[model samples]
Target: MSGIEPVEHMARISGGIVNWRKLLLIAAVTLVSILYIPDAEQLWSAWLRQEEFSHGPLMFLVALYLLWRRRVLLDYPDRRGTILGVGAILLAVFVYALSIKAGIQNTRHLGFLLLIFGLFLTFGGVTYARFVFPSLILLPFVVPPPSFLNSNLSYGLQLFSSDLSVSWLRWVGVTVFQDGNIIDLGTLRLQVAEACSGLRYLYPMVGLGVLTAMLFDIPLWKRGLFVGIAAGVAIIMNSVRIFLTGLFVEITDMGISEGFFHLFEGWVFFLFSFVVTLGLCWITLKRSERKSLGRGVMSVPEPTGREPAPMALVPVTVALILCILFLPLATYLRHLEPSIPARASFNSFPLKINGMIAEEDLLPGVEQEILQLSDYFLGHYRTGEGPPITLFAGYYEQQSAGKTPHSPRVCIPSGGWKIEDLQTISLPRGDTTVPINRVLIGKGDQKLLVYYWFQQRGTFIANEYMAKFNLLWGGLTSSRTDGALIRLSLPLRSEQEIPEAEKRLAGFTQEVFRILPAYVPD
Candidate 1:
C-alpha cells in the first residue's frame, strides 16, 4: 500500500504543475499576431464600404480558431528536432520579407500562412507542418485570381446571364432582346452586369462552406454537396432579385428598379443567403458525430509539480522585442516606395432640371426617338463638335492599348435605339499602340474631351499583374503618369476665346441639365 501511494502522489504532482511554457508562448504569439493584424483591419473597413468582393478578417479568425482547437496535436512527438522548427521559422520570415518587398497582392494572405508555419515550427515542429499542408489549398482563395482571369470570367458571365435571362423572358411570352449585358423586356430593360454575376458573395459563401465541412467532420462528398448547394442558392437568389427588380420597373413609372431596388434588394438577398447557409450548417451538425471533437490526443508526458522551463519565458520576451521592433521596421520599409499620385479631378457646372429630357433636342431630327435617346446617353459631350460622340471612350482607350494590329477598334451595338458604332480608337505608341476614344455631345459649338491612356503595353487595368508590379518598381520599369488625357475642344466664335467659350459652355450645360431631371422620383 505504501509503494502504490508513492505512484499516486507522483501522478497528483504531475497533474498540479502549471503549463507556464505554453502560456508564455501563447502570449508571445498573441502580441505578434496583433502587429500583423492591423493591415487586415484597414482592408476590411475598405471592403465593407465597397460594392465589389473582398474577404477580410474572416479567414484569419477561422484559421486561428481551428489552430486553437487543434492545440493538443502540437503536444505530439515531432519527428524533427527543435532546431528544424527554428530553421522553418527563419525560412518563413525570409518568405514574408520577400513577399513584402515585392509588394505582392494579398500580402496579408502570405503573411498569415507564414505565420501559421512559423508558429508550428516554433512549437509543433516538422510533423505538424506536414499534417497542416491542407491549409495550402485555402491560399488560392486568398490571393484573388489574376485580374485578366477575373475580367474575362466576369465578362463571360455578364454575356451569358444576359442572354439566358432574355431567352427565358422571351420563352415566357414576354418581348425580349439580348444586347451585351442588357436585356430588353418590352416595357423595361434589365442589365446583367458584372456585379450581377454573384461574384461579391462567391468567396464568403465558398469559404463558409469549406470551414463548415471541416468543422463538422462531414464526409468529403457531403462537403462538396453542401458547397454546390450554396452556389446554387446564390445563383437562384441573384436571379430572383434581378427578376423582381425588372418587375418593379415594369409596374412602376418612377424608375425605382435602378437605384432603390439595387440598394435594398442586395441586403435582403444577402440576409436570405446567410440564413440558408446557417440552416444547412445545422442540418450538417445533426448528422455529424466527431465534427465537434475538442482537440487531438496529447503525447507529452505530464509535468511534475516543478516550475516550468525558462524556455516558456524566452518566447514571451522575444515576442515583446519583436513587437517593439516591428513598427519602426515597417515604417522604414514603407519609405522605400514612392508615394502614389493623387487622383485627378473634373470640374462641373451648376444646373437644375425637373424631368427626363427628350432625345430630339440634342439629336436634332433623329427619326427613332428611343434610339436617339440611347445615343445621347451613350455619347460624350465636348465644348465643340467635330469627332463622333463616345459614351465610355475612356474605358475603351485603356483597353485598346498594346495590340498586334496597328489600330484596334471596338464597336458597341445599342439594341434599344438599334444603332452600332465604333467606340474605341487605337493609336500607335513606341512598340505598342495606345487605345483612345472620343465622345462628342452638342452640335456645332460644344465639345468635351474624354481620353484614356496606358503607358505599359500589356497592362490595361489598375489591378493587372504588370500594373501592380510596376507600382512596386516605383515607375522605374513603367512610367508613373502613364495614363491618357481627357480633352474637350470647344470652338470659339469671337476673339475672346476663353471667356466666350466659358459663357457658351455654361449656357449649353445649363440647357442640357434643364432637359434632364437631376434625380429620379420614386
Candidate 2:
C-alpha cells in the first residue's frame, strides 16, 4: 500500500507460468463446464438467433481474455474469507441442483458464476478476487434475462422510442398521433417493433462501456456513469432514428426504409452512440489525470502486492468435486421430466363458463405464436344481452428452455395500449383465495380491463419472478414444470362499466381456476 514499494516487484511471476495446482484447477473447471455443454450449446443457439442477445458469447470470451491478460497481476489475499467462501459454494451447489431439477437455465447460469466466484475466495481469497472484479461482474450479462424481464425491458424501450419519435415528428410539421408503441404519421404508420426498441445496440454498448472502464484506471462512479450513459445514448439515438424513419416516410411517402436502409440507419446510430461512450470515457480519464496532478499525489507507483500464489490443493479439490458432483444431477434432471397426459382439448372447452358461452368468431390479430405456447385457447365469452369478455389460456408443457409465458405488460405497449393502472386483485375461488394481476390498458378513448395470473403446478401465482421460481421448484420436487397463463380481457366503455367487467372476470376465473389443472397438467 506504500509508494516506496518497487514497481518491478509486481512483475509477472516467472514470465506467465502458472503453478501446477492452479493449472490443474483451471483444467478441472473446464472439464466441469464441458459436462454442462448442452446448456452452453443451447445458449450459443440463442445468441445466433436472437439479435438482442447476439453479443452474449462474446461477453464471456472478453471476460476470460481480461482475466488472462492480468493473470500475473493478481495475488492471494491476506485473509481467505473462509466462512463466506464456503457459504457461497454451498449456495452455488444448492442453486445448481435446483436449477437442474427445475430446468431454469438462468438460475443454472447464475450458479456457474457463483461457483467460480466462490472458488476464487476459497483458493485466492477476497483480495485476490478483487483483482478480477470487473471481469466477474460482466458474467451476468452473458445470460439473456428471463422472459419476463426481456419482454418488460423491450416494451419500456419501445414506449420511450415511440413517445420521443412522435413528439419529434409533431414538432417538425408532420401530423402524428402516438398510439402506444406506434406512430401514426397521416401517410405512414410505424409500429415501434422490438427491433426499433434499441436493445440490440444498448446491450453491446454497455458491454463496450464495461470493457472500456476495465481498461482504464477510472473511479468506480465514473465507470458506472459510462455504463449508464451508454444505455441513455442508445435509447436517445434510437429515438432520433425512429423520428427520422417517420420523417423519411412523411417526406418521401415511399417504403424505402425497410430493408437496406434500416440496417444502414441502425449502423449509423450504433456507431454514433459507441463513439459518444468512448468520448465520455476519454473525458473522464483526462479529468482524473488533472485531478491527480492538482492533488500532488501522482509522484510514485505502488504494487498491489505479491503475484497469485499456487492454488491450494484442498480448496481447489473441494470446489472441483462439488462442481463434478452437480454434473450428474444436472444430467438426471435433464432426463427426468413431468408427465403430460392426454387431456380434454381447449378446442372442446365449454362455451359456457358462468353462463358465458364462447363466441363463434376469433378476434383479428389473435395470434397464438406471439405467446409462444404449446397449446392456447383464445375466445370471446359472452352472456345474453351483456358485454363480452375475451378468455385466453396459454399452456406450456414445460416452462424451461426459455419457453415461458410472455407477460402482457411487455406486449401491451407494443400493441398500442398504454397501461393506465396496474395492481394485484384477489377473488374467492371456493375455499382458497385466488390472486390475479389486474391492468387497465387504454388507447385513445378505448379502455380495457385485463386480469391475468400464472397457474403453475396447480398453484396460482401473481408475481412473475416467484412464478418462475416455483416452476423450477416444482420440476425439482415433482418433475412438473407445466404451467398456464390465464387472462380475461374485457372492454370498458362507460365509467360505470368497470364494476360489471370485474364481476364477470371474477365469476369466470372462480370457475376456470378449478378446471385449469385438467388441461395445463400442472
Candidate 3:
C-alpha cells in the first residue's frame, strides 16, 4: 500500500507536468501566429492569386499530417530541449523584422519556416527535431519561388519546350517554322507564352516528389534520383504536350490551341508523368521494401513511457521574450511610410531632345492598370529620316510585393519577342559611365535593341539583384523606396544594321540620360 501511494503520487505529478508543458506550447504557438499575421496574409493572397503557388494550401495540409503522424516522438523519455534553439529563434526574428521592413514577402516566408524550426527545437529537442525534419522542410514547398527565378526558369522552359516541339514536328514531316518561341505553320501561328512554360506542372510535381520522398523509406541517393526524375518527367511531358498540340492543330483546326481540350490534355499528361516517375522510382527499391511501400513509412512504434522531466523552460521562455521584443518593432517598420521626395511628374517630361521631334503615346488602359505605375512617360523621337528611338520611364512612389517596375526581361518575352542576346554595357553619362542592360530581342526576322536600367534614389542599377538589394537598403537607411525603370529602344532592319542601331541608341540615350533625373527624381 505504501509503494502504491508513491506510484500514484508520481502519476499525478507527471500529469500536472504534461498539462503545464502543453499550456506553454499553446502560448508559444499563439504568440508566433500573432507575430506573423502580415506574412500569413501575404502568403494567403499569393496562394489565391498565383496558379504556381496554388499547391501551397495542399502542401501545408500535408505538412500538418506528416507532423501529426510523428506526434508519438513528443513523449519519448530522452527528449531534452537544446539551447541552440534560442540562437535560431533570434535569427528568425531578425530575418522577419528585416524582410518586413524591406517589403520582401519571400524572405518573410523563410523567416516563418525558421521560427517554426526554432519552436520545434525548443520544445522537442534534437531527436524529435530530426524525427520531424522532413515535415518541417515541407513548409518551404508552400512558398512561391522568387520572381526573378520564376521569370528566368519559365523563359528557359518556354524556349526549350518550343525548340523540342518544333524538332519533333519536323521529324514527323509536319511543315513548321520555328521563330523564337513561336511555331509558324502557314495558316496557323502558336506562341509558347509563359503559361505554357511547364512550370505549372513542374512546381506541383516537385512538391509531390517531396511528399513521395517523405512517404518512402528508400536509400538517400534513390530518393534524390526520384525527385530529379520527377522534374525531368515534367519537362519532357510538357514538351510532349506542346508537340501533340501542334500535331492536333495541324490535322484539325486551331480550336485545339485553347479552351477545354488544352486544359484537359495538360491534366492528362501531368497524371501520366506522375505514374511514370513513381514506377521508375519503385523499381529502384529492394523487393521486400517494395511490398511494404506506404504501409510502414510512418509506422512509429508506441512510446514505452512518458518522461517525467519538465519541458525545457529556458529556450521557450527566451524564444517568447525575443518574439515579444521584435514583434512591435517589425510591425512598426512594416507600416512605416517612405519619405518620397518632391519631384516633377512624368507629365512634365520633355518631349524633344537631341534635335529630335517626339510624339507621345499612352499604354492601353489594361496595360496601365497591370503595370500599376504611379507615373510614366512613353515617347517616340525621330530626327529627320533616321529611325525613331522609343523612351519609356515608369516611376513608383513606393515599391511593394506586387507593385514595382516590371523588368523588361520578363515583359518582352510575353509580347512574343525572344531575347537572343543580353548583356551589361557601360554608357557614358556626364564624366562617368553607368551600367545598363542591353538586350537584342527578335521575332520572325524583326529585331529590336533595348537599353534599360533601374533608377533608385540617386543610383542607376542594371542588375535586378543589386537593384533589389539597394531597394532594401534604401528602405532601411533613408526611408525612401521610390524608384523608376528607364528604357530606350530602337528597331533594326537587318543583322548588318545592329552597329548603326547601337550608335543611334547611344546618342539618344545620352540625351535622355541628361533629362531623366528631373522626372525620375534620382
Candidate 4:
C-alpha cells in the first residue's frame, strides 16, 4: 500500500507539474532545431558582431519570453493541422536545400522560423498560431535586412540625411556646402555614409515598436501609428546625430570626433533613440491608463480553458525522413548541375604596358577580406612625371553567400572620406563603351577620382544592383558565380581640374584595356 501510494503520488505530480505530451512536443522541436543550429548560430554571431544588427540578439530572448508568457495557449490536441505541419516542415527543408549552396543566411532564418511554425501546428493546430501570431510577426529584428532593399533605401536615406544635416548646420549659422552626401562645414567635411543612412535604426525601431506594442498590449490602430512614427523618429535622430557631430567638431578639435570618439558618438545617439522609444511607449500606455500584460520572469499567460494532448507522431516522423533524404539531394543539386566556367587568369598580367611602369602594392588585412579573391593584382601606374594612378583588380572564381565585392559607397565614408559627387560614365573601350561608376571623395582639401565596375562572368556592370541581380540569376540557373571588381583611383594634384582628370583617366584606360581581358577571363 505504501509503494502504491508513492506511485500514485508520482503520477499526480507529473500531471500537475508538466504535461507528458508537452514534453514530447518540446523534444520533437528540439530535434528539428538541431538541424538548423548552425544557421541560428550564424544569425546570433551577426547580431552580436555587426553594429547594424546589434539589436538582433534581443529578439531571441524576446521570442522565448513571449512563448513562456503564452504557454497556456500551446496546449491543444487536434490532428487537423498535421498535414499543414508536414507542409511547413517540408517548406523549411526545401528552402534550406536551395539556399545552402548560395549561403543566403536570410533564407536560412526563414526556414528555421518555418520549422518552428510547423512544430506549433503539430502541437496546437491552427489555434496556437492564431492566438500567438504576434510572436511570429515581430521577429524581423534577428534577420538581416535584405540587400535588394538596401540599394534604393540606402541611397535615398543617405541623401536625405546629408541634406537634412546640412540644413541643420545652416540653422546653426555655420558656413556649409552641400554636394550629394558630402557636407563641407568650412572647418570639417562630413560624409553622410550609407551606414549613417538610418536603415539600421529603422529596422530595429520597427522591430522594437512591434514588441513594445505586444508587451503593452495596446490597440491595433495605435500600435501601427507607433511603428510608423518610429521610422520617422529614426531618420530625424540619425540626421540630428550627424549635425551634432559636425557642430561639435567645428566648435572643438576635430580629433574628438575622429576614430574611437566617432564610434562612441554613434553608440550614444543610438542608445538615446532607444530610450526615447521607451519613453514614447510609457507615455502612450499612461494616456490609455492600462497595466502591462504581465510582469515577472515566470508569469503565466491568461487562461485558455482545458489543455489537450498534442498530435506529434506522424508529422515528426515524416519531417525526419524528409530531412534525412534532403542532405544527399542537396549535395547533388548544388554541385553536379554546374561546371566551373573558364575565365582569364591574372598570372600573365604585365608590369610594363606601353610606356607606363607598374609598381605592385599589397592590400591591407581588412581590404583583403573585402576583395575575396581567387586572383588579384594591385598596382600603381606612372609614366615618369605626373602623379600615379592606382589600379586594383579582384577576381572571384565563385561568389557564394556574401563573398562578393564590397562597394565603396559604404567603405569610403567609413574611412573618413566624404563623397563630393558620384555618377556613371561611359569609357570608350575599342569599338564599344564600357560604363563605370565614377566618384570624387575628399577630406579637407585632399581629393581623389575613382572609377570602378564589376566584370561579371561575361557582363560589365556599373550599377551595384545590376551586379547583384546578375549574380543571383546566374547562381539560380547555371550555378556560375564567378565575378571581378576592377577599380582605379587617381589622387589629384594641388592644381588639377575635372577635364584634366577625365582626360588622364581616359588615356590610361585605353592603354590598360588591351591587357585586362587576358587577366579577367570571359
Superposed on all Cα atoms, the candidates' RMSDs to the truth, in angstroms, are 13.0, 5.0, 3.2, 6.8
Off by over 4 Å in 4: 1-24, 77-82, 130-133, 146-159, 178-183, 189-203, 219-221, 255-268, 280-317, 324-347, 351-392, 406-453, 459-466, 473-480, 486-518
In candidate 3, stretches whose alpha carbon ends up further than 4 angstroms from where it belongs are 1-13, 77-81, 256-260, 263-266, 295-297, 302-310, 362-371, 409-423, 439-447, 492-503
lDDT of 3 by residue, 425-516 (tens): 99999999999999999988788999999999879999988988898898667777899999999988887999989988898898888888
| lDDT, model 2, position 456 | 78
Worst 10 residues of 4 by lDDT: 292-301
lDDT, candidates in the order shown = 0.45, 0.73, 0.79, 0.71
* lDDT of model 2 at position 129: 63
Identify the superior model by TM-score, candidate 2 or candidate 3: 3
How do the predictions measure up, each by TM-score? Answer: 0.54, 0.86, 0.89, 0.70
| Each model's backbone clash number | 16, 2, 1, 1
lDDT of 4 at 293: 48
Q: TM-score of predicted model 3?
A: 0.89
User: Positional deviation of 421 in candidate 4, in angstroms?
Assistant: 13
Which residue pairs collide, candidate 2?
351-357, 351-358
Is candidate 2 or 3 superior in lDDT? 3
RMSD, candidate 1, Å: 13.0
Per-residue lDDT tens digits of candidate 1, residues 233-347?
6665566566556656656754667775667456666767867876865665543444443222212233344322223234334434554565466555445653333322211
- What is the Å distance of residue 196 in model 4 from its true position? 4.8
